[model samples]
Target chain A: MSQKSEGGLQEQVAQLYGTYVDMVYRIAVLYLKEPAAAEDAVQEVFVKLMHWLARGRLQEKEHIKRWLIVTTKTTCMDELRRQKRQSTDPIEAGDFCSLPAVWQSGQGPDGERLREVHDALMRLSEDCRLVMYLFYFEGYSSAEIAGMLHMNHSTVRGKLRTGRRRMRILLEEDRE
Target chain B: MRQEDIREYFRSQGPSETQKDRILAGVLEQYEQETQGEFHMCTKTKRSVSKIVAIAAVMVLTTVSAFAAVPEFRDWIGGQFGLTAEQEADLAASGTLQNIQASASNGNLTMTVHQALVDEQGMYIIYDVDSDDGSAVDVSLDDLQFQASESAGVFLYSIEQKVLETREDGVTCMALLTGLEDLSGQEVSLSSCGLTCRWTVGETAEIQKIEADLTGKDLWTGRPYHVTGCGLSPICVKLDLDGAERLQDSGFPDQVAVEVANTDGSVKTIQSVGSCGKETEDYRYQMFLFDEIIDVDRVQAVYVDGVKLN
Candidate 1:
């Protein structure tokens, strides 16, 4: 890239880091299931983006945003797989919910409710969690998420519906 | 638990303050590293490379404006800088908020050190520089630098400063500190090595900054005066204390009358005293108003915190 062209890329990279940092952290926390691990993944994700930007690989704002989300998910998945390989004991799927909650500090009922929602969200498959988070919290369309996740649009919609049902059941069970 | 409500709830959910600072600090650190080569605004001078090297020393959490011991000042400063409430709370809780405040006034210009918060890696300062004349004066981020006389150990990692706002009273400024050690507890001074501020009132519009000599001439508070001691060993001068403080700025305490009486009936008044806090208040080692090392004999009268000693 020309020296003049690199200016926009640098600006966008700064924007991505500032604007969507929390989004990246939430996604990483949902998959990695630990605070330290999640923070590390968030940093690694940005660092990777920087490396890409340095190499002149990133060109557009929208593309960089999608790349951040996708790469955060991938980074967490790799770490989880690495953790599983290291465990001498067999790790089960349900073990994720049972994993110690990286409970972020909040106050009162709203805080409690959000914690409950996050706990339930983490119990869903990483794919479901990512898709549902994008659809609801980030306000991404199924088609947009489909492209980012490289899944069929219908498949993304199906997961979103199922993820909603699962989260309701988990919260309701806690209440009972 | 409606799905929509829960979605909204999760949307509101974000990382904790600790996690956010950790993430942002890491990311910005990387950005600052690469961006320095690309941050092209302050790099026009021959000294630009060194200035860039200075800012490359350490990173200060971003700050925008306000100076010193005023409550209204802090509030305005908080709003101006991109500091979150959480970060302010953190700095307060860490005791960095109650930092050293120093001020200096030359005959023509007055500079006040409003707030300086130092951490392990750096310190941040908010200050105001006002000309008594109050015409056109400017201190760019390019001009402000930090140097601690005592702290020779710490090296400048990086310095990011901005002239936040300008008013007739003075120009509001903020500086980001990056260093190897904590500077909050230390006494440091601000310098404008390539200070370019000027008063357009003069016949030629005298550059106030050019008048600011970096060779220990202009201090943020008062010009530092050097006085030599007269002691008994060589019989040059005994009990003649050096490094006395002059009544210059608001930061200075009240002056004590110190005089070195010589056999020749010549007595010199010392402006400031050197004491170790509340205890061991020794005023014999006073800053005598002497540009040259004066040779005196015999002991002189000492005033320890205004209490005269016979």
Candidate 2:
């Protein structure tokens, strides 16, 4: 690439950093479950980003969100692979169940509620959890989610509706 | 807690803004160590078009990146040009859109549809039209169009398609058939029916000049283009490429991508340039739609060599 193009690439990556750094961290932590490991994973994602740009693979700006989330998940899985845990076992193996020390470490009622809700969300089945995150937090449609996750559109819908139902039940139970 | 409360909590928990800078700095530092460039934060310019819009309104900005990848952003584009959200939903849910891989074989030319992207922008069929006999298809905007047999949806017809690449077997390109219409639950087909000219690599582009409001240079040609106006409301860019249109038709180079920086320090990338209006004899008028919108007054469209167009 020319120097000018490389400069543009640098600028685009910098912009991506400001916009997606936190989301990338949250996504990495959602799977890695540790701030330290998640932080490390965040670094890995951007490194992958440099490669993605170098190859001229990104066609449009809208793809950054999906690319970050998907890449973080894949990179986290690679990290998990090194740990010898079944990388595909998102919720079934109780991987993300425990809330990290810092998140629950906040003081008072709001903190407790945050911890409880976080725990409950982490405990939902993998498909439901991912569907819920992509839908509510990331703002992806069921159709877009299906395309990204490589699942049927209807299945993504089912998981999302069911995910909400499951979360509602868990939160309602926590109140009682 | 309600689902929204959980959502709020999920959104709330993450690295702080300062930490974001640090982590990103560290990542780039590591990348530099690995790739070996003069890596530093102060020198880099971040892509900020969507970020600025995102900060002002999350709901509006999220859906663009959250959906279309640009072509999927057709509705947002349509909504700008007078299409309703309900209409967009109906078209999306119609499911009448067809995806056929059928091939069109002429004596030395063959056109095949790899896939079709249907959204608010209508149907863009990415196809391969190649000639083993080394025959070149006319790259003019007027000579190409769609021939719909059966229809359930609207079809705003056009013959202009941007040929992205020319491969040994065929050329990969995208054709925008309509704006208000779509292929959703409809029967549509595109062919090089009226293609008369054999436009080869050495062929010159026929982009003429048009009248406009604002004036901006074509950077490469040093010729001023008549830009009617610049808007941040769904951000429309009208650039009349005089000598530069040659690259679009032939596989030559017109290298015209820009980053518009707002006064508030946000940058937006302008790509996938297409025509929005008629052609002029001395200029090839084209427009690029940026994904996000800015407050027009504050927009500083930064070009190469610090040429700012507002």
Candidate 3:
């Protein structure tokens, strides 16, 4: 890029940095759970965006948004993988149970019941958990999730079915 | 059990409006910042009609009239700045031009200018900042004025006409300033959108505050803008009490010592818990505290007493 173009890109980046720093941090916090790691993830994503812009990519606003989320998810997964490799200690079970239960209409089960459901969901594999999150929490359809995660539609459907079944069983156990 | 049940549960957990506003502001700002360069570039190319026609006329006239005929042109114009072919094409397409303002400071003084035009195809003004040393420079917009109709957010400004037109862009009303080239480079660059310009003068000053605070009912969005605080460190539980005493007193095994480790390898201990009861046999307990606030959906692991329960 020409020096002038480079300067322009820098100005835009400064603007973006001013605007989105917090949102990126929040997303990172949501995924990484470690403040340091979340900050690192957010910074890394922006740096990556800068690099891409320098390379003449990141063509649109939607592209940038998608890049942020996808990169954050990947960063979180990378952190998880690194911890898994270095540590021999068993992983903690569900922390969702630690939260107090409060219920409102249109909200699913009460907190206690939800915790039970979450605990059961935790028992499933990580892939299953992710599929469930994308489908349920994110309000993504199986097809949409398949595209986002780059998985087969059938596989996404199967995972959703299995996840739902497992959750039902767990909820039933809670009732019992 | 049902999808509705799950949806309700999740909806109940949705972030509060304040949090959403903060997040959305950040998201929108990032989006705007990232794309603004291209937008400016496109705008610049579109608005440079007179310059383009002049340049083209000069190029054609020089070829036909002979280079020597325009000898005084070099002295009269000093130099000719022509857009690259790609830039020209981009200009033809977008039909818009944007001017940016900036400020610079020497040790004893500061000067501001609205320097460059940009178009969608990505072009900008270049100057040698280091040509004169001991001078620091910052760029901003000034005297950004706009008017909006009752509806529409489309802002139209004619740099040559000195007219500002504002219209609705869907839901938001946009303010537009035209004929910005008439303003000094410094003022144009430092101009703020949506509100009055607040300039702070000092030796070590940074930004000239341009308050873009939305008015009246628009404040329902919760402050036209807000900054998100830094992420918090995960909460830690310290177990300083003797496990043996509590476990023995509670009829629990002293051999069972509980340890907690975060994903980052930071460790803590869980002391004074009784021995595994009958219920412990059927159900396992894994305690994992997040190192920071997180969306519940994004939480990947929760460890309990140093066990990979998840």
Candidate 4:
């Protein structure tokens, strides 16, 4: 790719850094379930972003976001594949259940509740967790989310219902 | 805990600024390592670069003008929202459309509020984002939110649909805000960070409401549905559907296609974008937005999936 001037490249990076860095990190954490791995994924995605900027392929903010979302998800998926291939131990649900160390290590006012919620979230399947996150947290309707995630609308609703029910049961079990 | 609590829990978790800055630094370092020698070696002089940029700008402008002249504001609303020309005219004649000129700026980015089309259900805000410093405008409908004036008592609104079109200099966005109490003639503020614009929602178009409680089976899916409420105007039809828990069934259809039987025995189809189903604790609430507005006085009966519910 043809390179932009160093100053121009820095400006683009600075503009996107504050806006999307946390989002990229959070999405990576959600998918990879390991802060260290997620951080590596974030770096990879940003490096790819630099290439996009150098190529002048991105025209606007919306395009950048769409690209980031797809790229981050793909990066996490590739990491998961690599982990599965590398691990000698059996790949199981418990293997991917770690909440970020920040939430697990620190106990604030809402720490216990946060842990409970995070634990329940980690227990759900990856698809369910993503659907639930987009629906409840991001406030996207099932149809809109289906378009974003490229799933059937019915499937989005199904995952949401299943996720909600499972989270409720898990939280209740934790309380007991 | 409730769904809102879960949302809050996730929302509160993210990497801190220090981590973000570290990641950015790493990215920049990697970029420099990857592109160092090639970048400086290929760099053009400032004068030649500016000449090329100016030529490219003129060519881009010519191409933009030749291929895609920005549609007039009303035409944009009609095209974006799928309204017909007659429907657009009816909305204007009924005083449902208002021209609004409100704007807010943050640094190089400026968000301008242009016009609003209001109905009994909600309104569509037409706006555009431009960057004065020639940077790419990076705003989305999710970034923009509406809050009623303090006196309006904490009203809630949902963006049902958004249409974005990229233009030469900026991005134009039309957002349909629904699921709110009547906002007619009420002062509301829309803001995204430092960019804020306040305007009064103009007088809503006078539309007819048909209180519907008709239950029928969908012929295509053989599933049952209830029409809880409906609104009619010369330009649009808003129908609310309650699936009564059948929405959870696999293969449940979203779009409840409606065919309006006119009084003169002609049938005019009220095209739907699709079924927008939002599940609640007990029922599935589906909203049907018709693309074409029809003559309300002539709509004798409305049929869905071959079942008449009028």
Best by DockQ: 2
Flag the better candidate by TM-score, 3 or 4. Answer: 4
Query: Which stretches of model 3 miss by more than 4 angstroms?
Result: A1-43, A50-56, A88-90, A96-109, B8-310
- Candidate 2 retains true contacts at a fraction of 0.29
User: How far in Å is the alpha carbon of B82 misplaced in model 3?
Assistant: 30
TM-score rank, highest first? 4, 2, 1, 3
Greater-TM-score candidate between 1 and 4: 4
Q: What's the lDDT for residue A172 in model 1?
A: 93
Determine which window of 10 residues in candidate 2 chain B has minimal summed lDDT: B199-208
Which rank order by DockQ, best down to worst?
2, 4, 1, 3
The residue-by-residue lDDT of candidate 3 on A4-25, one tens digit each, is 1444444556555545555555
RMSD to native for every prediction?
25.6, 19.4, 26.0, 20.6
Residue B172 shift from truth in candidate 2, angstroms: 25
Displacement of the residue B277 alpha carbon in candidate 1, Å: 86
- Judging by lDDT, tell me the better candidate of 1 and 2: 2
**lDDT of each residue in A40-155, candidate 2, tens digit only:** 88998887676556445453556656767766765665565444333354333235433545555756657777776786777666447767877888888997886565444577
Interface RMSD of 4: 16.4
Question: What is candidate 4's lDDT per residue for B1-310, written digit by digit as tens?
Answer: 7776787677765665555555655665565565542221112223332133343344333333223211134346666556644344335434355557789887777888887776655566788778787766666656777887533555544564454777655777776665455555567777753588887665455445554545543344545665566666444455555654555564556465678999799997766653444455654444455555455545678776676755
What tens digits encode model 1's per-residue C-alpha lDDT throughout A1-176? 21222334335455566577878887886676666777888987786666456545455667667777877875676566556546644333334332324334546546667667766876788889888878887889997886566454567888988898988888899788
- Expressed as tens digits, the lDDT of each residue in B1-310 for candidate 1 is 6666667655555666555655655654554454443232222223322232233222211111110111122433345444444333223322333323455676567776666443334344667777888675677666776665446764544566767778976787776654223332234467652332221010000000001112332222342432222221100112222234532322333233455555466665554312111101343222112111222112334332343333
lDDT of 4 at A135: 77
Q: What does the lDDT read for residue B34 in candidate 3?
A: 44
Give me the TM-scores for chain A across all models, comma-separated: 0.80, 0.79, 0.64, 0.84
| Higher-ranked by DockQ: 2 or 3 | 2
